[model samples]
Target: MGQSFFDEQRDQSLVKAAIVAKYFDAWSRVMIANAARGIRISRLAYIDLFAGPGRYKDGAKSTPLMVLERAIADEALSKLLVPMFNDADPENVASLQSCLDSLPGKERLKNAPLILCSEVGKDAESMFTRARNCPTFSFIDPFGYKGLSRGIIQSVIKNWGCDCVFFFNYSRINAGINNDSVRHHMDALFGSERISRMRAALIDQLPHEREVFVLEELAQALKELGAEYMLPFRFRRPDGSRTSHALVFVTKNPLGYRIMKDIMAGESSTEDQGVPSFEYSPADARCPLLFSLNRPLDTLAGELLSRFSGRTMSMKSIFESHHVGTPFIERNYKAVLGQMEVQGKIVANPPAQSRPMRKGERTFSEKTMVTFPSRAA
Candidate 1:
């Protein structure tokens, strides 16, 4: 599966690349801009520990080359971008180095791409202990649950501006939770104490309940490790029969969380009652049958109304405050707010006078200052 993973860019793979590249670009821009004003951030780095071959057999480029392409084109990034690619496979490292060598303007890069071939468990000592010089963005995408550990994440995110996005193989973990053979790996991933609690809790729970439990446990572990924000984007199998894996992004910055949320929301293949599902399900592209009358966003909308009753605030403020534990993104909040507006529940300053429509109805945005009535009218 390692080599075949880069066979061709599938839906989930495409989504992963999109999320990582887009967020990396956004993260670099912010950190660089902040550094200009004498912020603590001095530079930026992009590390892909499980980086596969740079391109697919069909000539599709993977994340490593995609990121280097961005650096080669931008003069500022070329000067500050530290591009590093590593894979346990020697063949992959060779191929990635060759592909990276072909990138135009690679010479302008401040540091040539650092390509490595070594076992992550053996060679990643510095990653688990040493502090990075710059604000590093790490993509730890292991095929299974072998090399990823809580300390690996705990280390990367300790820096002021550092952040990490790792592949969380849920299916592997769910199967390994009780299996004694891989107990140590699971222990390392979630810490021994946390995994013990997780194992005890998983007993007698339904499948759905188990999923929620594990996710909550992960959130708790991330918090304990100093990751203030952890966002998970799940990917279902092609047939949508069962879960496949997920990409979990962790950061200490709320702004990073917000930027990554928008990126993940865009790739969601399904939306429940108008809220992005945050999972890619290729089987049911539109998932019309599943949207049933649950209208999850309606509940969220009401909760917001009650929480900030009679108070005026920007949509941005509402999103920042209300979106931490919820699946609703800024767009989802805007959708529900637009519904409330049309129903006379809330009012928006500088109302939608011009082009604005979603499913032939008006929508809201972050900039629009909105006022919630003292009570639902």
Candidate 2:
């Protein structure tokens, strides 16, 4: 939480492990649903791009290895041709081998089709090429953005109809853009100048919505990669001080979106409500559940709006003022704005240049504002 590498690593491992389990459960449920509908997927393959050590330092199990073990033991999933496990760390590779060896059927490890490499992205690409004909799911959980590139993702999804669930470090990306030293790093990670343009636009138009801009840009990139739908979820720390993690699910299938929304809804205990409602309104109605375990969007938005005294404010200013991260802003702020506009509780003003912040020879400005309804009692 304090930006320490060990702390970050530990937090990420826990979040990734939980996410891996969520997907495993979701995938199993999906398979069961398909079978109920008379459709059977005889083969299933999984790929982990950043498969870490096979065991956590605390002796907790590794997510990638756990998934492999479950797949091997599940008669339904084991019927699949084979599954693949990958990691970039040599120690992790050795650890994974040891763990697999200790499993019930050591010799049957071959059936799982495990591969360990120093460069997981390259290996993942090669693995995708080899399994081009089979349905695959790839988990891209890098320590940072360097391990995954837009091109590599495009290749994997395009070459093999693979669906990806990725861990996007919004905080890191935001910090990178805000700081001048890492500006060039953005182009390398995102593969375009558009990120700069969007960053500028966000700083200009909806300064308060900087986090929203990041989420939108990320979702748009996923769309460009051919994923028709995405589900973004945030994980928070226990103290509720900050967002520790964010997960995004990308798939080209509408059914995948429907299923994800349904699964998320069920997980939220929302009682099988149609699609997870995205509706937002200023008036107090039942608070809709946010996908995050920490900061619910409604709570954040309400608190922020109240702080502004329900006055009209620009999106950019709002984002900067609250320090809300991108995932939260994108998923919740827009809906809150939409609800306020509909209820006539607030009105949007024409975009205007934000007050400048001076640093060196440059001036930074933002656009986006909100005004309270004139007739509101």
Candidate 3:
């Protein structure tokens, strides 16, 4: 059967909208905080390469509109924001523009500039390249695996202070990779001839691992392109048996990586390790709730104990490391460390025993160092 129009695919799932909302809120807060820290005054840009018609048939807001909502909510952010929404469909472009015009604070956003472009191919490339000069958050969510070639992603990744949250169309790409007719498209998508070899390697693996293996390779490719942090959020079947697709976030900023990790963790089904799996079916009672904090500290505790066994480090040091994500912040880290100390797993400096005091005293501070008892003396 021929595929339905992209606009009509609204009934598919609401999981994507939830994810976009969480990330958009985080992006605005992070940018505002960064600006407050004297991080050079400049405009913030949001580009949605495959922007839809702002609203779905189910009356849900798409990526572009969600971003617009965030900007409008914060006056400071709205003033510094530059929104560029584009789609290949001219009908979509018109609809998106009309949607913006109808917004409550549409006049306020006018000064910040909202560029709606109806272009594809080179014209689209030119639009993206223009956003390269400033700090930009791009939502490169394409319907299929066609437009976002590796080269295009690389160009955006190379842009100064640019962070991308891309939709990796794993199922589509995996199904089409072996077909001779789709080889050129695959080459363009991956920006390499190594995909064939990569696919061959996956054939011997388990069904689930096949999806993960390809995504890991894609993450590694982006890393080679200079993404300091690469985090992938997996959206799998409700039973957690196979994969659907993944939202791959690539960035050069450590702080951005940390914030995004926390946001994804909050949205994940299991607070285990690595990329979290989430399903947002309204009728499915098994799906994780939207705002639940799924005990990420417990997950981080085991990893921290294992990785930092013998080392003595300050709470600040551990919190500032690249390894720390949304599961916990400085306060949570200190509390966990204190719990470990009480359990005789680690020793704390300025010893908790030294200060005989009230119950639930704050035991670990950024200055206080901790050493695991398991470490070599």
Q: Give the residue spans of candidate 2 off by over 4 A.
A: 1-15, 28-42, 106-110, 142-147, 158-161, 178-185, 202-208, 262-377
Number of the top lDDT candidate? 1
Q: Per-residue lDDT for 102-158 in model 3, tens only?
A: 877766664444545543466667667666676777777533434556667677777
Which candidate ranks first by TM-score, i.e. highest? 1
Global lDDT of each model?
0.78, 0.57, 0.66
Give the higher-TM-score candidate: 1 or 2. 1
| Clash count for each candidate, listed in order shown | 0, 19, 1
Candidate 2's residue-wise lDDT over 1-377, tens digit each? 11222234554455457655666656655665675687655556677765666677777777766776676666566656356666656667777778767766434433655666645446566766766665667777533434456666765556334577776666677677656675555665554667768666766754336666677787777677776667776544443334445677777664555455444433332221122322112211243343233435546545655667756667666654553222333324545654555556565554222333344212212354677543334
Root-mean-square deviation of Cα positions for candidate 1 versus the true structure, in angstroms: 3.1
Output the lDDT of residue 322, model 3.
23
Which runs in model 1 stand beyond 4 Å of their true positions? Answer: 1-4, 7-9, 127-131, 142-149, 350-367, 375-377
